[model samples]
Target: MSTETVNPVTGKIDEQALVTKANRQDLRFAIIGFVVLVVVMATLFALVLDFMIDGVPRISGEFLTNYPSRRPEQAGILSAWVGTTLVMSATAMLAIPIGVAAGVYLEEYAPKNWLTDIIEINVTNLAGVPSIIYGLLALGLFVQIFRLGQTILVAGMTLALLILPIIIVATREALRSIPLETREAAFGLGADKWQAVWMYLLPAGRPGILTGVIVGMSRAIGETAPIITIGALTFIAFLPPAPLQDTFPFVNFDWLNSPYTVMPIQMFNWISRPQAGFHVAAAATGVILLSMTLLMNGLAIYIRYRIRRSSR
Candidate 1:
């Protein structure tokens, strides 16, 4: 039997070897270019980073865990650490349900029609929009729309909106990757749509969901504009209070309304200063942020591997 290539535009059969040679060439160039870019970027970063740490104490346990200080040689990123964690966790809490649910509705239940197509296009477009725009949205709407105040809650909700599309798209792709046979099997067993999607498909797609959630959270964590726009503080003397509590011992709802700060903002604020010590602190902060992102990515991969291996 002869192969045929269907022209997408002309709707004519035209069997071609385009996907073969073009794909190989594209992959070759992409890998080469990416390697070159990484090398050049790393070299430049190393050169400049030398200036930032020429003569500064690069290690101290106190510096790692204590709160920031006006004193150049004495400050730490403890508060910012806790604050970033709080903001990110809060963002995840807000984003996961909405994003995953949207993905579920679109992937598992939506009809193959114009409406679903439009929604899919919109989601892709939203993902491409600049992150700072979402920051502005948080500033304008969350701060002013319903008067949520400039708090972690509002900042998180804003970031949730910003990254929800990404999560949805990733989840949808993951869901689509599920073997069609599995869905049919579930259906044949009298499983409802919801059950097939959630109980079965979702568990199967956990790796992808986790991957998406972690990536989205990383973006939210690194974001400074929206939080700054929503009035993230540079100084907070205390850790964030628990989400729900009146007055047990040390927990309170003060974090929702009070001024807060996060890792990126802290790094930004410190790096902007004129002191060498602040610059070193900035470098340390960079390492911390990098470590966090890498750790999350690694954990996600590990979990995915474990899950896939077990499922086999």
Candidate 2:
């Protein structure tokens, strides 16, 4: 009787080669599945794009950067441009430090306990909740509880909360990716635990943190529902004032506290109009938004690559 032998180098048995051949054949079916997915996504995009509408050229120079006009045909999203910049600036201000710090604590300092478990669970779950619910929470808590009013400040804080969980999770993953040997080496070098994490873990995780914040900010930029709920005025003709603070001496809160609008809200305002021109403007607005999101993603990728290269 002849027995089949397993090749240790390739980890293939005589009979297993036959199974591998069948698996290779199965990959062709997966390619079909992927092609189907791409086609479906493209079809959906065509249906939703403002540019896809027949014969409407709404993207004029004025439309790209002009103030809102009483005439829907003449309205541009300039104020919304200011609003979005302000909102994102504010969201980044609040979200990055708080989220990343919390993540660092959990990853480096937190003990494995039921309390931490519950926190981790809640943070994960919070990320999945509808943006509208977060908006409602902002309306009730930030606006109502502290009476911040429906201004940009209130909306910014609310959005900060919405993205906080995401940043924290990303930070943890980045921190976790640092090898245990690195931590032990730091310990061996007579560095304290905090110092070890701050010096090595943070640098290693910096890329992930940057990427996470950019991704979070990308979503935050497009969030109209939450800001709308918090009273981001649909149309404003004025550029928001530069930030000024009497106490801070040079910081202006107008950049932070004024009635603001962002690109998404402005696009939404245009899309809702009865005018056909405004619909075209909405598509143009989407193009602008897509550009910004892509830019942010690119920046994040660049930062990650640079850091990884330096570390290597």
Candidate 3:
């Protein structure tokens, strides 16, 4: 009995040696990948830590309540943060339903054809298109043609367009991840396509869908070029009209048409100033923006976990 795994035709060791060689290659690839990941993560961590060290002490009660001013110490992000919130609310409202519906239709309902293929290709390409392009488009379509002005509504619509491709791609990919067997099982249970998708597939894919939504929003929140191009004020002294009115309906849509500025633009304004105090203010704004992004991602993770646990 021979111990070696020999190829009888070649009369040499073959299977065993090949298997050992392949395993070694795999191990080497994994080790290299891990090292690269660690290096990238460490670099990012260092940058964020530096920001926190410089900015954390500068954040004070007044900083959150006051508006921008020539005196950096007196200037605050009150208007910037409020504008960011309202614009993000509008972006999410517009982007989520439209993007998700487009994705679902293309993935499950649309027939496989050249038109669908072209649509999918364009969508994937759009995800990689520069953010400035969306800004330009918004300037033409929303600002000039539609006469929406460079208001909060226009900014929101611009960002919604920028992130639409991301949500759509994420949605289609998430749905595609569902096992064919799962779909068959749903059909076997006498559920129609729409019923199965709504009742089962969508639920199963919710976590991934939510993850995509959060990621798109995170990108949208940090975007400056589109907002700047859309003429977001660099130094807004006043806040938009309050969404909650004191009388009548109690809720008003007046803020949508009001001029606005977001955190990134505010930070940019500070950074471009010659004063060191303004630089410090910029760093502080960065910290707040980063915190907001992390909070959104954390909330998404928590929601996804709850959904998965409940399903199980």
Candidate 4:
């Protein structure tokens, strides 16, 4: 099926000209896309290289275990890392179930009416709202109104709010990706909506849902503004009380009430210092942060892969 036709006036087919014109357009777009990709990769490579060169040698066992100090040589990220883990753990626990449930309700159970439409629109809009705004809101509501203070709990709750819309959107998308026939088949088998969703649609869509969770968590983990607005200390010197102390019950909710700091805040504090040693330490902290983020993403990918395989 040739697209070309003879130019009757020239008494010859213009097939070669047409093909060349089409190929030229395709090649132009391809080259542009490739150049953009190369530029992005190059930029990322340069940043990673800088971190390695200026950061890696500074990383050591002492850096991992010791607390922050006024002296650059003595400062470590012990409290920062601990706070990050605790806050992220709390954030995930609070956000995932609530966010996913909201998404499922909106996507699967809610009527296609004006109220649902408005709610959906707001959720979508919130996803794009500046992170700083979430910080401000958390400062007012979580820190002041709730009287949570500058604890890991407050920071976690604030971050949970910040990433909630993202998780909801992601869950809705994942639910939507499930085939309509699957639902229909479940109904035909005498299953209720809840059963269909729980037994069939949820498992089918778990991978996409997990992907969204990972993205939301990643965003939450890296955020500084919200935590800072809630007055998260930048120079925390001690770990929050352990979740499992030697108390009778063997569990401590009091850890949530303690002061906290995170990797990003710590890195920011270091980078702002006048000392070159602090600068190097900042880069090393960046390396650790980057590594943790990558590890989280990789684990999510592996989990997604496993879920997909199991479903098959």
Winning model by lDDT? 3
Q: Is candidate 1 or candidate 3 better by TM-score?
A: 3
Q: Kindly give the stretch of ten consecutive residues in candidate 3 with the minimal lDDT sum.
A: 1-10
- What's the lDDT for candidate 2? 0.81
Cα-based lDDT at residue 70, candidate 3: 94
Per-residue lDDT tens digits of candidate 4, residues 1-312? 353555657868788877787898899999999999999999989998999999999999999998998999989999988989999999999999999999999999999899998998999899899999989998888877988788888888889988899889888888987879999999999999999999999888888888879978988878887777788888887778789978699998888888999999999989999999999889999999887777778887787678667758
Stretches of candidate 2 off by over 4 Å are: 1-31, 44-61, 244-248, 298-312
Which candidate, 1 or 2, has the higher lDDT?
A: 2
Model 4: runs farther than 4 Å from truth?
A: 1-29, 299-312
TM-score for candidate 3, please give it.
0.83
Candidates 2 and 3 compared by lDDT, better number: 3
In candidate 4, how many Å is residue 162 off? Answer: 1.0
Using lDDT, rank the candidates from best to worst: 3, 4, 2, 1
Best by TM-score: 4
lDDT of 1 at 205: 90
For model 4, which pairs clash? none
lDDT of each: 0.80, 0.81, 0.90, 0.88
lDDT of each residue in 117-226, candidate 1, tens digit only: 99989998999988778878877877788888877788778889988997998788779879999899999999998889877999889788888888888777777776
